[model samples]
Target: MSVLDRIIRTTTADLGARMVRIPAAELEARALMAPRRPSFAAALCAPGLSVIAEHKRRSPSRGAIRVDLELTEIVRDYERGGAAAVSVLTEERHFGGALDDLTEAAWVCGLPLLRKDFVVDRYQLLEARAAGASAVLLIVAALPIRRLEELHGAALDLGLDVLVEVHDAVELDVARSIGARIVGVNNRDLRDFSIDVERTYRLLDGMPAGALVVAESGIRGVDDARRLAAAGVDAVLVGEALMAAPDPRLACEELACACG
Candidate 1:
C-alpha cells in the first residue's frame, strides 16, 4: 500500500478506539467550552509571505527529526522568529505527535495553531478545537470529494479554519469545486514520499483567484521563501529544514525576513 493509504488505515482504526473511549458527544461538549483561538487564515493573509512553522517530530520518509526539542520550545522559537502561525503534527503513529502537543503549543504560544494531521473524520475536528487548534488540514488525496465537502463544511460550522491541501492539478480542481478559500499546495508526493519544490510553482497558476495560497514542504531556506513570495504565495509551511536546524529560531528568522 502507498504511505498515505497506510497512514489513513491506521488513523481510522485508532480513531474508532478513541471515539469509543471519549465519545463524540463528550468531545463536542469540550470543544464548545474551549477558548477561541487566533484566526489562522487571517494570519496567513497578512502582508508579505507569512510563515507557518511546523512542529513535526518525524515523517514516514525521513525518520526522527529533532526528537529532543520540547514542543513548547519549538513553538516559542517559531513565534519569536516572527512566524505567522504554527502547525503541530498531531498524527501519533507515523509522525510521533499527539493531541496533547497541540494543547501544549497553544498554552505556550499566541500564534495561531494548525493541527496538521490526516483528518478523515469530523471527530478529529472536535478533537482539534478542544485541544486548542485554530485550524485543521484536510488533504484532497486523503478523502473522497463528497466526504471532503462534508468535512470542510463541518470545520467551518465549528468556527475552525480549513487548509484544504492539494498536491496536483486534479486535486486543485477538487479544491476549487468545493470553493476552498485557503488552499495549500504540497510539494511532496505522499505516495512515494518524493519531493519537488517546483511543484508549488507549477500549480500556482491553477489556484483559485482570491484564494489564500500556502506552499508546503521542501522549503529549504531564505531563497526558496523569497522566490515563493515573489510568485504570489501568501504563506509557506516549513518543517523539516527548520526542525533539523541547529538553531531553529535563527533559521525561522532568516526565512521570515526573506519573505518580508
Candidate 2:
C-alpha cells in the first residue's frame, strides 16, 4: 500500500480508539464547544493574501521541528504578528502535535484556529468544535465522495469552516463535486512525501473560479509565499518553516508581507 493509504488506515483505527476514549457528548461539553469568534475565510479575503501560521513540533517527513516552543508563546506571537489564522497540527503520530495543542492555541490566540488533521469521522469534527477550532481540514485524498459530503455538512452544522485539501486534479474534482469552496493545494505528495512547490501553480490552471485557493506545505521562505500569492492563492498554510524559525512571529510577518 502507498504511504497515503497506510496513513489513512492508521488514522481510521486511531480515530476509532480516540472516539471511545472521549465520547462525543463529553467533547461537546468542553468550554470551546461554543462557536469560534473569528472566521478563517474572512481572514483569507483580508487586504492581502492570508497566512495560516502554525504551531507544530514535528512531521512524518521532517521528524522534529519545534519541540520546545510552548503553544501559549508561539500562538500569541502569531496573532500579534497579524496572522490571518492559526493551523495547529492535531495528529500526534506523524506530527508531534496533539489535541491539547489546538485547544491551547485557541485559548491563547484569539484568531481563528484550524484543526489540522486527517479527519475521517464525524467524531473528530465534534472534537474540533469542542477544542475551540473555527475550522477543520478535510483531505480529499483520504475520503470518498459520500464521506466528504457528510463531514462537510457536519462541520457546517457546528459553525466551523472546512478547508478541503487536494493534491492534484482528480482530488480537486472530488472536492468540487462535494461543493467545497475553500481548497488547499498541497505541494507535498503524501504518497512519497516529495515536494514540488510548483504544484500549486500547475494545479491552478485547472482550478475552478470562485474557489478560494490556499497553498499548503513546502513553503519555506518569503519568496515561496510571494510566488504563490502572485499566482493568486487566497492564503498559505506554512508550518515547518515558521515553526523552525528562531522567531516564528518574524517569520510570519515576513510571509505576510511577501503576499504583497
Candidate 3:
C-alpha cells in the first residue's frame, strides 16, 4: 500500500478506538457548546499572500521535526510573527501529532486554526469543532467524489470552513465540482510523498475564479512565498521549514513579509 493508504487505514483504526471511548453523541454535544471560531478563509483573503504557519511534529517522509518545542509556544511564535492562521496536524501515528495539539494551539493563539488531518468521517468534523478549530482540511485524493461531497456539505452545515486540497488537475477538478470556496493546491504527491513546488504553478490556471487559493507544502523560504504570491496565491501553508528553524518566530516573520 502507498503511504496515503497506510495513513488512512491507521487513522480509521485509531478513530474507531477513540469513538468507542468517547461516543459520537458526546462529541456532538461538545461541538455545539464550543465557542465561536474566527473566520479561517477570511484570514487568507486579506491583501497579500497570507502565511498559514503550521505546527507539525513530524511526517512519514521527514520524521522528528522539532519535537522539543511545546505546542503553545510554537503557536504563540506563529502569532507573534504575524501569521494569518495556524494549521495543527492532528494525525497521530505517522505524523506524530495529536488532537490535543490543536486544542492547545487554539487556547494559546488568537489566530484562526485549521485541523489538518485525514478526515474520512463526519465524526472528525465534530472533533475539529469541539477542539476549537476554525477550519478543517479535506484532501481530494483521499476520498471518493460522493464521500467528498458528503463531507464538504457536512462541514459547511456545521459552519466550519473546508480547505479542499488537490495535488493534480483531476483532483482540482473534483474540488471545483464540489464548490470548494477555499482551495489548497498541495505540491506534495500524497501517493509517494514526493514534492515538486512547480505543481502549484502548473495548477494555478485551472483554479476556479474568485476562489481563495492556498499553496501547501514544498515552500522552502521567502523566494518560494514571493513567487507563489506573485502568481495570485492567497496564502501558503508552511510547516517543516518553520518548525525546523532555530527561531520559528523569526523564520515566520521573514516568510510572512515575503508572502505579503
Among residues 3 or more apart in sequence or in different chains, the pairs in candidate 1 whose N, CA or C atoms overlap within 3 Å are none
lDDT of 1 by residue, 199-257 (tens): 98999889998999999999899888889998999999999999999999999999898
Model 2 has how many clashing residue pairs?
0
Q: Global CA lDDT of candidate 3, please?
A: 0.94
Candidate RMSDs in Å, in order, are: 0.6, 1.7, 0.7
In order, candidate lDDTs are 0.95, 0.85, 0.94
* lDDT of prediction 2: 0.85
Angstrom error of the Cα, residue 31, model 3: value is: 0.1
Q: After superposition, how far is residue 1 of candidate 3 from its true place, in Å?
A: 0.8
**Candidate 3 lDDT score at position 115:** 97
lDDT of 3 by residue, 1-260 (tens): 99999999999999999999999999999998999789998898789999999999999999899978999899999999989999999999988889999888888888999999999999999999999999999999899999999999999988899999999999999999999999999999999999998999999999987899999999999999998888888999999999999999999999988776
- TM-scores of all candidate predictions against the true structure: 0.99, 0.94, 0.99
* Candidate 2: stretches off by over 4 Å: 28-33
